[model samples]
Target chain A: MPHDSAGHTPIDMPDDPDARIIRALKALLIGRGFFSADDVRRKIEELQSPAPARGAALVAAAWSDPAFRAHLLADGKVAAAERGVPVLEAGLIVVENTPSLHNLITCTLCSCYPRSLLGQPPPWYTSKAYRARSVRDPRGVLAELGWTPPRGIAIRVHDSTADMRYLVLPRRPDGTEGWPEGDLARLVTRDSMIGVAPALSPSAVGRDPSGI
Target chain B: MDRLRFAIGQRVRIRDLPVPGHMRTPRYVRGRTGEVTQYCGSFRNPETLAYGGNGMPTRGLYRVRLRQGDLWSGYRGSGQDTLEIEIYEHWLAEVGKGAPDAP
Candidate 1:
């Protein structure tokens, strides 16, 4: 295998425009005083390490503990930081789902997600179609996403338009009495925390080989 | 004392005025009436923050709710359904209170 200057085998990229552009940009930035290679690598590593699991753990903890829930509701940024979840400088506002109101999140202008907590956003979330329809019709969008709240419950859509980030504090499902926090965390999915769907229910959590 | 003009539960309308550069308020809710849900504290204006200028002028942030029927034409959802947006103080005005003026 022929290795490039970095001594790593060159990956397949005959016509990848972005790959070339990114490589050139990195070289230019490092050549100039804009950013060092280490800085870029550090940022990529940090982003890759963080995922929805962190948010799920927080939600699970909140479900079991009242005091932590109170603190989280009082000040989301502080609570997440206190629990060691690197609260991004961009403010995070946690909204709780209640029997009366259901919350839906969408970024109408752009694809600004809670990357600091959730590892990555699905492609559909950032698409223009979802961005437009979510604001125009939230209930229709929710049903398509497999989130069907009991009839007569109101849906509230939150458009993250600015520097602020939001995390949905999904209501705990019933019949989960005394479930261990670790097990409960499994019930939470990335989309559930994003308010696109409700947290996984006990009835739907079937045993798998990996014990999801 | 906080410099906020509207209190929680107050009925207000999102202004129809166009904003320069970037804006947090979506177009669908413009000129629509809604109730203030909660105060999200004062923060540097994002419109200015996006540009190179210093985002010095802080504005009160809020979570406002509007009925789904009010925004969408021929809406099928129950009248109880509502949509909430995080809007700045400058983009809202007191409505249904004696010829309310724009902010």
Candidate 2:
């Protein structure tokens, strides 16, 4: 094992049993014509593309249609069942942000997310800093995510457990009413679902950077 | 290990196991009790060694619901609101029923 300047172990792995096993597996898999490291990287990039539109569509539909919103709140699994999105079964709860009591989700231990609704988690969602600080200091974590809750509004931080996963239903942005589902879907960004940012309005669209 | 089963509306206490590597069992609910509001289908436990330590697979997962009040006593929120979570069979035991005491 390689020691740091202070003679202490840093986060990097050494040529220990676990490292040897990973090296062996990598060699065997690469030799067997399986996915190379580059292939895996490409696959992840493909999955993380602008595919959030589908989930955005669902969120927009819920915002526009009260009946659909009821279905979504009542049984999110069945509401999203047609889309073939897998709902996390562990006493998983979906909390919608109302005019009051905004909710945010963080995986304190690991990134346990709703793959069915959001497809794939963003890079920032899995950071060790996010995992550790979210549970202890949720308000600070939200600030780091670039979200500043309004004064006098209480912030509720929900730490996702291994058995429980959480999804935040951000409030619909203003000036989006009577808009088409496709247009509204385009406004629903990944950051909105995580409660870090609000959904984009028609004017805010195309102003932000292209692609996730 | 036998296939564990519990009906909806039944209360169960979550257990904590010192499994090497990754596990889906959250540290907070290690010894907490919550009611089972749903009967999710079963498959091979993902917490098993075969599924890797981390939560990378969902083929053999079970979905369950837990009320917020049940999870935390004196929880202040809308009484109708409930939180749902997916837990593997290995992380649960029937409370005050036929299941053994959680260690």
Instruction: Please provide, for model 2 over A1-212, each residue's C-alpha lDDT reduced to its tens digit, 9 standing for 90 to 100.
Output: 86457966568868889999988998889889887978867877855553566567778778878888887767677776655555544433556887666676777666777765676887878988776655445556677667766644555555555444556677887766567777777888877877677677667785333232
- lDDT string for model 2 (B1-103, tens) is 3344766677777767666655666665666677675444444445554455543433333445555555566654444434445566667777865455443
CA displacement after TM-score superposition, residue A107 of candidate 2 (Å): 2.5
Model 2, native contacts kept: 0.16
Question: What fraction of the correct interface contacts does each predicted structure contain?
Answer: 0.63, 0.16
Q: Write the per-residue lDDT of candidate 1 for residues A1-212, one digit (tens) a residue.
A: 76457866768766588888989999998999899999999988977777799899889988999999888887888898888987775788887888887778889989878887888788999999999988787778888877667767777778887657888989887767788899888888888878889887877786332333
Per-model chain A TM = 0.83, 0.72
**lDDT computed for candidate 2:** 0.64
Model 2: docking quality category:
incorrect
DockQ of 2: 0.18
Cα lDDT for residue A203, model 1?
Answer: 72
DockQ of each: 0.65, 0.18
